[model samples]
Target chain A: MIELVYDVHHQVTFRWLIALYFYFTGMSAGSFVISTLAYGFGLEKFKPAGKVGVVMATLLLFIAPIMLLLQVGWPIRSVWNHFTYLNFSSPMTYGAFLLMMYPINCLIYGYFMFKGDMKRTKIFGMIGIPLAITVHGYTGFILAFGKARAFWNTALMPFLFLVSAIVSGLGMMIIILLIRDRFFTREKKINTELIYTLATMLGWMIVFDLALVFCDISVLSIAHAEAKEMTHLLLHGELSPLFLGIENLLGKVVPMVLVLTPKFRSITTITIASVLVVIGILFMRFVVVYGGQVLPIV
Target chain B: MAKTRYAFVIDLRRCIGCNSCSVACKSENSVHLGVWMSWVKVIQKGEFPNVSRSFLPLLCNNCEDPICVTVCPVNANRIEENGIISTDPHRCVACRYCMAACPYEVRYVHPIKKFVEKCNWCLHRVKVGLLPACVEACPAEARIFGDMNDPKSDVSKLLAKHPVQVIKPEIGTEPHVFYINLDNDAIEKKRKVDVL
Candidate 1:
């Protein structure tokens, strides 16, 4: 048996601030994609969400990087340095461009949509699809490039993050659509069919997310000595409560069951599932950023 | 001409776990109280009469293929001609990406300035023909610092003569820190090495 006598602990590099940053970026990317669906892909059904989606997308993107500045010591310098000198090898460099371009595209897209210029709105929306994907996808790439953290180093991290962003975006869209129809519009009525369709989409996305996470965990559980330890940490160790109980159980699984089940497809159940998904995605970011480095590598 | 490969060798057999190197590094670098650029790890193994303790001096590996340089968004971390990887305080955004990427966990955020800092093999001292504070203060002479390319240097001689090992070589960082008589127990212990 061996026991540690003395060792120094450093503060976790990416904490709640980074998690919030991830959460907001995911929210922003999700809504941007949703906004693009009606205009860019010409999905006529998603027309109603197109306007509000662009608004949420832009505002959330604005707030996301503010969390990043607070987390880093030098905020103004960071912004300056990102443009002046960039190491393209770094995944963060990719985000600097995406974060700038995506929001401007969002604003332009929203502008045209509001001005009733369908052609211009469609053009901007098409441009935003890749920007939205890259903005949030690069965050995953940042974590993946941190090769020391076993959980963050996976190749599928970008795809996992992208899919989850869409899931959370759909969750927010349902709630937003309801509030808009009931309170914001001239006719005070809830669009049950649109809400149901969005909820259905959210359910399938969560299933896809679960399958991806299962693939990641299953491989990591027996990958290597350290990988096994990390899997153990999430499965039944200190982070298990957050990872298993809140993130998987309360967040993804419950929401999936609620929305996917036909008997449970009432307004109340769908709303609760939507709320759970938003909360769950937030926790997923926490689990990902914090849990990745919770266990010491050296 | 080939670049000089700066390397460090820790003779663990001579390391009595005195922590003089740690103290010397702190006072020289003005490292804050809560963090350390260099420290010694102590581990105890076995039970009672069979018990044995080992000391591991922890510092930046200054890898030949330093991951920190590759990931710095602002290009703050630079690999000098002498092989010392240096971080520019003015340029660093305190992003902590390097700290997370480093396998040795050698990097730290300055408690006040917030920019990341780590052991740079005492480039300031080495450039002016002085030994690193840690090397000079080591009463046991366990810590040897020098250019690995120069056959006359202590680091090169010790590295050539001793059975040296580097931690986590599988990641292929090509770490420069070498250890003599490294105890597996010191590193292999399955516990959170860092205490919050």
Candidate 2:
């Protein structure tokens, strides 16, 4: 007998959803890391990226929901349900609370980053540092909390997400520097020393993220039939090419080789390496968001 | 304890996957054309001879410990005395933290209003002592509405007798929506898995 399935309606689009997911994930990562540098590591030298990071975080604060709207296909009415509380245990409920906290923390961080006054910056920094990490870490928890998707059901994901944000944020800052140095400040010499330092850090981060990817995949391979089904879909399913080519080769191996190698030791080489790493990380985010949905357990 | 507690119960067995509930929800709430206030997800599972499809109408589960409420810095979302979670458009700074925090991915920010919103369970209807539009419009008599606290209520009786399931039980949202005959793979079927 032919099995026929029915539904109320199909309101999702893979293409747009995937695109938006990558964009927001990148923004979240990029924004979080920049803020981290200002707060967590106490990199007082890189104050500019810190302030800019807060702005990026706020922009992403709004952009993420827009991405959700695209997923829901209804921007206006669907949003109201968030306010319509039936139960308190829901993650959506917590997410709403976190959403509110993130921007406030970011704005306060932004205030300190730009505020020339030392006392105010100190006070805001006191609050902004941990807030930045928690805010970014919460994004990872949101994904992991969904136990239905094995791809996201990992504790390491939050750290992975947190570091990936740092890698991208540094890359973005470097790209901005390259542009500014190349066109805006043609007289000033390129900061090769800093590039080498960040490039090395980025190289290591990419390695760590890839290593986690390996462990996650290997563990999932033997976990259960559901994970196996998901693995197969990711490897051979709709997102396979992206997972293999963009996320693996471009995002992982190629960039790692470029950064860690001896031949590409110059500042120009490091900049190019960072650029590739940024592209790779963006592709990885796409895979993470879209991959979680394509292989469905049932 | 407290007398004021509000919630919803969905009868999955009777739902026919018709968009009437969603449509009724949109019109009654004056939601925009492209934005949906409530949604119903249809998941098909199993293969060939063993294939069995299930219909799960998704809405805000409106959990007991709302992740969205606590994260809001502006206090846009508030749990009323009656158990309805709502956002004050005036207070909402249009931050979408609630959207990211939600495991169900139901919340979205309005394009024009620039505030977060989701299924309010028709607060307007609830205030008037009437059922939500979705409950009133169901052709299959699948949707039920009543107070969980009121022992004499039909919903209370149904919950007492039937073994019901909530979506993503492992997350511990303590959702109030009760599903009957919901297959184990219902939420799994809708989930998409990714690698690399």
Candidate 3:
């Protein structure tokens, strides 16, 4: 057996890694689901998020792998390892399985959406929506099952991921709609009513997520073991800036401010807010991946 | 069944922090830029007046329960009974799950090859009955490579004579590298051993 440490050492910051992966995957799945609200199920208002959802999904899908690649030291050998070593118990193995499944589903869904034939392909959308949720939810389950990190080892992670995905997906949709309204077409212009409806759901989820985060931190603080040390890293250590500044401020607070403010309801204001929220979500992922590893009980 | 188990033990007390082991592994492995097959960690611990540091040479621990092995979707990582964790470059898809799974952060991907690569414990040299390039090159004689199962091995003899500890025993990875006279405060604080 190789001698290993039971403490802090330099490892890639995983503080927000889990969050980031889930965010991207959530975005991909969430966008697909939101788009289906219009394209698949014939909900006209949901059409706003659908057009831009495909593009955002593609962007997020590509970026998610980059996060995985950077975490692993070798990007090339990682490809080979996936094919050669198939351990059913490993979350990564399962993640790979879902990763493969996701794109195919997207492709099928995309064909109908792009071909302007979603109305005829009711079965695909009906099948695709649940599949999207499954793919994204499973990502959360993979992390939740790992008892090593307290923050991730929760039954709520899948719900958290799913909620965050919806928020992000909707935020992206609104921004895309606004952009389309400005540049492309006003046919899908989302009225304040729909935007508020999406924002209200996002508000609840964000508050719930923060509550879980607070509870997780408190529990870790009380336990005061390796997990506690990691929690400390998240709360007050190198990661504090992200945990305190961006994730809370940009991701939650600013977006909330945008949605709630009477004066802040302008298109430009909301667009900027959406961009910040996206950035905040990315920061959350960084903290989660890097934070968990910071104080490992080696 | 044929077993290819590989293992390593580092004598922390004797480690001069010269980084000769890291240097040797680098040249031998021809590790690409911005990446390493083996590396060193310098940890410092304690208050200003009592602060002390130690140099830790790190490589693939070639663990019995290798985290990298389980996380790889492709079977890129394997252990020889001699105890070396070997990576098949051709098989690696660069997914990096192993990097996340590994607590050590020792494994690095070659920039050019994009294959998961780390210290192989100089398997090619060991095959010819030569010590690992790093072991042979250590100026302080801080490392020993041998079969722990064999009581006659030098590593086993050393373990019997001295008290030692691994870096992160809590993770239960069962690392092969052993540290002699490791700083208690450093271990408690879980800080890197390198002070400088």
**Candidate 1 lDDT over residue span B81-180, tens digit each:** 8899999999999999998888788998998998999999899998898898999999999999888999888988998898999988887899999999
lDDT of 1 by residue, A184-255 (tens): 899888877778888888999999999999999999998877788889989988889988999999999999
Best by DockQ: 1
**Which of the predicted structures, 1 or 2, would earn the higher lDDT when compared with the native?**
1
What would you estimate as the lDDT of candidate 3?
0.68
* CA lDDT for candidate 2: 0.65
lDDT of 2 by residue, A8-95 (tens): 2222223445445545645555655655665556776555455556676667766775665665433454456555543354444555
Question: Model 2, stretches more than 4 Å misplaced?
Answer: A1-158, A169-199, A215-234, A263-271, A288-298, B1-7, B12-20, B38-54, B108-114, B185-196
Q: Candidate 3 lDDT, tens digit per residue, B1-196? A: 3343455778887887777877787788886666766766566655668766766666777777777776666777877657777888767766555665675667655676666677778888988889999999988788898877777788878888988888777767788887777664443434322211
What ordering of candidates by TM-score runs from best to worst?
1, 3, 2
Residues A1-298 of candidate 3 have per-residue lDDT tens digits of 1233222234342434455666788778777777777777888866656656766676677788776666554556565556566777667677776677667666676677778885544666777787778777777766564444555656776776676677677667666666676567646554666666566555565676677667666776777366666666667776788888888777878887786577767656677777776777667655655555554423
Question: Candidate 1: which pairs clash?
Answer: none
TM-score per candidate = 0.98, 0.65, 0.76
Candidate that beats the other on TM-score, 1 or 2, i.e. the better one: 1
Q: What CA RMSD would you report for each candidate?
A: 1.4, 7.2, 5.7
